[model samples]
Target: MTERAIVAGVPVDTRHWIGGRRVASPGTFTTTSPVTRTALAEMSRGTALEAEAAVAAARAAFPGWAATGRAERARILHAVADGVEQRLEDLAAVETHDNGALLRSHRRGVMPRVAHNFRFFAEWLLTLGRDDFATRGHTNHISWDPAGPCVLITPWNAPLMLASWKIAPALAAGNTVVLKPAEWSPLTASLLADIAAGAGVPPGVLNVVQGYGEDLGRALVSHPGVRRISFTGSVPTARRIAAAAAPNLTPLSLELGGKSPLLVFADADLGLAADLAVEQYDNAGQVCLAATRLLVEESVAGEFTRLFTERAERLRPGDPREPGTDLGPVVDARQLERIDGFVRRALAAGARAVIGGGPGTGDSGTGESGLHYRPTLLTDVAQESEIVQEEVFGPVLTLQTFTTEEEAVGLANGTRFGLAATLVTGDRARAARVAAQLVAGTVWVNCFFVRDLRAPFGGSRDSGTGREGGGWSFDFHCDVKNTVTAPKGWRDHG
Candidate 1:
């Protein structure tokens, strides 16, 4: 299949990619661009029929894919990487149009990471090792066997990149996949299925089904043939998926919601700290790992708040495709309303909006009205308020002050989310101490959102379950088996 150049005006092909072919569905749902508020594509709304077909296809292909040598698998994955590199710009445009993330971000970082996900996992698989030891005159060889079929449900925010995070590792570990992308941003996943096929990934090795989460997602997760599931979304949906997979006892890797905190110490570089704090507004704060809760030392609260609010007010929310756009609209109108509701409630409760407190108009001349929410900063908020505890998942930041290190740690760990946190401090000992006390799975010191990809990445508490990176990814996607054998001398004697 020839790849199409996806742009704002061009219509996209959003069909189900099953068994390396474009499969049609009985109904279709329109996907609108958050930039223009116009229809960009009609996604095939998958049903039980499509779900059953996808699972059956994956089951039939799993044995052959698992039996294939690691070297050959790596080769095909490298080819997939090559395909991604060749179409990076096109993929970036599609994703920007579908999800309202900045096109520059996709081209510069996100798209390259998508290709790297495949290449990195491929190389990691080659150097992967298992346990081999002898005990009590007997030898035990531990091997990793690929789980059968995997169901990957990715979120609309950073759609293709997050999906690749799971798909690359799952495929490298030798599992067949049935990917059900978020209905709002299904175009890039379909494009990826084509890329995989053209790169010689076998039929049914990577299948994509598009539709709503309740119907299509439920069907995929609850399917009897699915052996593993990896989902990136909200906590409530993760719970629902957990309940659905309970019957089959299928293993799940869920990366859910987060109300992560950014701790700024008085001794830290206020300039750099303010820069990092404003970065929470990146992708319009749609990122799950963003440090949305700003906890500042009481002594520096005024200075930090001024710096942060100034930087935030300068952020430009416009058409994602424009090169000058600093931020883009929230995914849709529903998300816009949700973000506004939180800000409105906080204001009614006496929380002060330092800069933005409501929805943004189309005054930027690039995005539609009601879709863009201004980068917001709130101060004088109670520590236990909804704006502080809940995962707003928007360009909204709440500032609070703490007097002591213990109070800072307590406030940072107060939320139910343990996905990630950021600490900005000049003191090495203090940085280490605060980071150790942080309950998050990943903690950033003196920076924000710098990922190694080889370290474990996930959350705790209500944030998520399981981790994925390097060997951790394989651990979730494969079953470790131990085979025991008698010693050579003992076998001879027998």
Candidate 2:
């Protein structure tokens, strides 16, 4: 951690660099404050030439770097952990200021996960090896190795955290990279690139460009030199990345949005589940794995609403960086408008606001200014309500009731998105049965928004394909290169 990195929302540097030298023609763009719409930094957007420079630098370093021993890569990643930990506060503040995400989200959600991800991938790389498999008088030494240069595109919601999800593993797998970050939030990406370069990473191994996805993202993804693309964003954008990847047959891993369901069974712990589920809305339900839909058995819907509303009302919304503020406004004014629009559509179509509803209140998005939305719960929402079908991505939860266990599972799986689900039941048999039947990638028996860097994290259906966290990511970066060989003796012609 350098004292030079110790600053408060200033434009640090703009020249595009490769292997430690600042080069020419770095185009300029201004980064705005999501909180107040003020210009925070004047960044140099990467032109196609600059983008090419990054790709070319990565290409130049690929052979020597990828060919290096995995242990050497691991040591550098291990050093990154110390750098990240030392600068955790700076990172968190910057994330909150740039993305308008909760401050602790970076401290708790991003930082530890970033460190753990680096360490986890470092360990995972050591276990992968090329080995000989002999079968029926034939033998082959299967070689699994790095796939060369990788292009990673991360979302603003969890920028650095998601960056590490791809960055740490791609490096650990021995591939060089050129990362393109969302223009909505590029501070963390730029900071991370600087950190990686400073943390003993040989230059050209990592590159970053700050700009709109349409130009920069397209250039990075469509480039012929990129071997693999790892993207985390919306479904539409993922589709675009897929199309760009089609011509080159570039390997891809997409992690998109979700409309997760939280099923409340008759025999479940209503009080506890309601507390945890709605309590999470303080972060304005921006979490991808949040219980966006509450599907309760008819026998428990009444009880579920009672408990959920009681807890939801207690959550306070205000400035995200503040200590007592549980819920901040959604990321920006656009998101706040979208949240309002989603609720209006639901209300117009015959849904009732059971608890805090309408536009944001208090210090959150005031009637005329800032970005904030009230923690709201909508009941009596038609099963076909837009709120029910689409991801609100705000501090809102829609409710629907089911009669049987089968009905609950059917309703949960009925949506196009299947990212996460929470099943609450006292009986192990019932929990086990329903958890397995759920369509989501992850099913929490009684928990909500819980995560571990060492666990496989991803979704099914429109939520997107591919898994992150753990050593599982190595598969996303490195390809299976099975080498055919025989033991010490020559090719036996016996």
Candidate 3:
């Protein structure tokens, strides 16, 4: 199991990693590459039995792991980071091959962040502060205790990176983990288990189970032994998980879907604004935090639209493995059809497609037909239209004009989602004013997608529940306890 077998010319090791060993499932499922529209690998299709085993293993390992010294945990986490860095190129390649995102992005942006997730949390654990104070003649000491076994369910869009975001914090807080990566992309998650073992993580400390959400995911979240659950996926799935875990009353953190907006004012730099708008097309618009809804001031709408359309059309779509490819195919044919359906319905509803409006062929000619969708920009859509109100989750952008500042804010906040938003303006007062009013968990003024690992990251309303990053992450993974003691001489006096 140490070496991967070649499937369709891609190296793949498909097995469940449980109790620090590779466990074979009763059945297997094939995962397809969006770029080639062909079978990429045969993955272990986990059942409830596998899920139960993973949970048991995590539970068995929890006590020793939780009791491990902070310094030793930090050292082990650092070693994990070192292991990730050593396989940076290989991991990036496998991620791109499995998920169809641009290889350059995985190599330069995503993979580096994966390593940093481990390293940053490792350092944060040693320096993490707890409150200690005296009040009412009593001294109180606050400490965070590990919350037992944790189950982390990650999405397919950025499998390894996002998984680490949850994994690092859980491990840093001294909790054992059972990771269930999205079925569409499980190769990297499997590889990560190997990486963890190589870095000296003890058996049963970290386990990975690959399968659909209905069976494996349900079992993992509903299991009574699971003390904490963190899931990143669609709203419907989150609701289901919540219902499943309700009986057990297991603490849950859910990061769901978003239809984020980007606001552009007349005073904003047109060039920078346009650049930010086009960034929504990155990852083929699979990003949960992408600003798919563009709200522009009427005075600058025409100018901004022209700039955005020009840059978007110039983007190169090709094989993700190519260094020059700016955009890759959507995850699969099903996803491609979903994107097309959204655009078609919008068009029929009288919205105009200013640029690309349908399926596109890859420039590399290596992929199957209908795998690529052109970067699309829509205009003249009503405020209440489905295109504007829903999360397309594709390379599609909808533009709406706002007559006044109040109207702009209304349009931006109209949707049920409140994941993230971007405000483009030169006036510092207006930027601060509008940013404060935006109903999103994360708001960027004069920038987009700029992330600081220590900053809080999550959504509001339908976007998600709870937050993660820095102390917030620790808050979710650990139980904060307050120890109170009476004044030293009070008992003597009594």
Candidate 4:
């Protein structure tokens, strides 16, 4: 409602920000709006050259940044948080317009959290200190050192927020970084570069390169100067990056895809379960940790299904800019089609649709238009079916039944991905048992998607490679060095 935030339909700046300046590339690509299926802006396309330049800048700045005082680093981070808060509305508007995320969520959920990521890491860094312990022969000192130049690659689903997750910690730990945001949603990232510079982040300590992953991503991963890489996206892409980075032997922290499960027991509050089940369709179910698989106790399966389907039907799909829209369009046509294909394949393989099962009309008065898919719920879906096993990454939920606690645990852990899981049970013993049995990095007992900044967040098996949060994130961005020295006039006792 401010003039700067009047961004219902606008094309934002699309140039790269490197070394505290705007850098343009020869080739460009048009980013299309998922809400209108129209060209939003032509972004400057970066290639190996631009990526190399960005890396060189970061590498050059690494030594100075690493030696910066902890207090100064924390101060800069605080300033960055302050800058983001100042531009919160504008950034939220740009994200909703570029990524098709519901504005309501961006305003209330995403943007505010972006500032939190910076503030949390900044405050945490202040608590850190060198550790020293005495041994028989010598005293050992352990300290964390910066990982040097690092590349942060974030996906488009929650662009600014996810980028903040990587950028905040990397900088807090005294590493210079080159951020390559998904081309589909690079506007706010561009804005962030300016904000960081304005907040007194030294030139080259933080840079942004806007381009497709294939060109820029490969170059960034293999660059010798990039000491570390933190990426969040699909599993297949993570695998590719892992292979590419193997020759360099660079450290990588990948938070890849997920086929997370949500189990509802007979003792759970059925209404709450149903409500949370429908809420999984947030962001049109494009979240990496969305509850795609729903396991229910056989005794209450039918009742839960009925309530969930009713809630799913009432999900108000509309344009993301609309005030009351519950669901927005998918990121693009390809993703929307992919979601539909999954539903179709499941149905062909004998899954039953309890409610919506196809593309939505975008007429729910939520203001949605392009690339809109209905909130779908399917039952009778086999555990082995692709829809149930794979990461759908859309607003589609598959239902299955389990009679026993052991069966539910088996079903929940069946998927290769193990990013997250949720268990709804009133029985304290059952909650603890199932939570421990579920093979996920994070498990919510009788709740869904509640996260603490200090808690570790990542997956097991095929989901990801490392944990990141609070100290976990600090560890990833830093190298632990142990120093040992003999005390004056001391000798080995043993």
- lDDT score at residue 412, model 3, on the 0-100 scale: 94
How displaced is residue 22 in candidate 3, in Å?
0.6
TM-score of 3: 0.97
User: Which tens-of-lDDT digit does each residue in 17-93 have in candidate 3?
Assistant: 99999898878878887867777777888999999999999999999999999999999999999988998888888
- Regions more than 4 Å wrong, model 4: 1-11, 362-366, 489-494
Q: What are the clashing pairs of model 2?
A: 143-481, 143-482, 143-483, 282-327, 365-372
- lDDT tens digits, residue span 334-390, model 4: 888899999999899898888789988756454667578888889988888899888
Query: Model 3: residues >4 Å from true position, as ranges?
Result: 1-4, 7-11, 362-369, 489-494
The better candidate by lDDT, 2 or 3, is 3
Writing each residue's lDDT as its tens digit, candidate 1 over 331-398 gives 99999999999999999999998898888877755554458888888988998899998999999999
- Model 2 whole-model lDDT (C-alpha atoms): 0.77
Q: Write the per-residue lDDT of candidate 2 for residues 63-84, one digit (tens) a residue.
A: 9888888889998998887788
lDDT at residue 61 of model 2 (Cα atoms): 91
Give the Cα lDDT of each candidate: 0.90, 0.77, 0.90, 0.88
When sorted by TM-score, best at the front, the candidate numbers are 3, 1, 4, 2
Q: Against the hidden reference, what TM-scores do the models get?
A: 0.97, 0.92, 0.97, 0.96
TM-score of structure candidate 1: 0.97
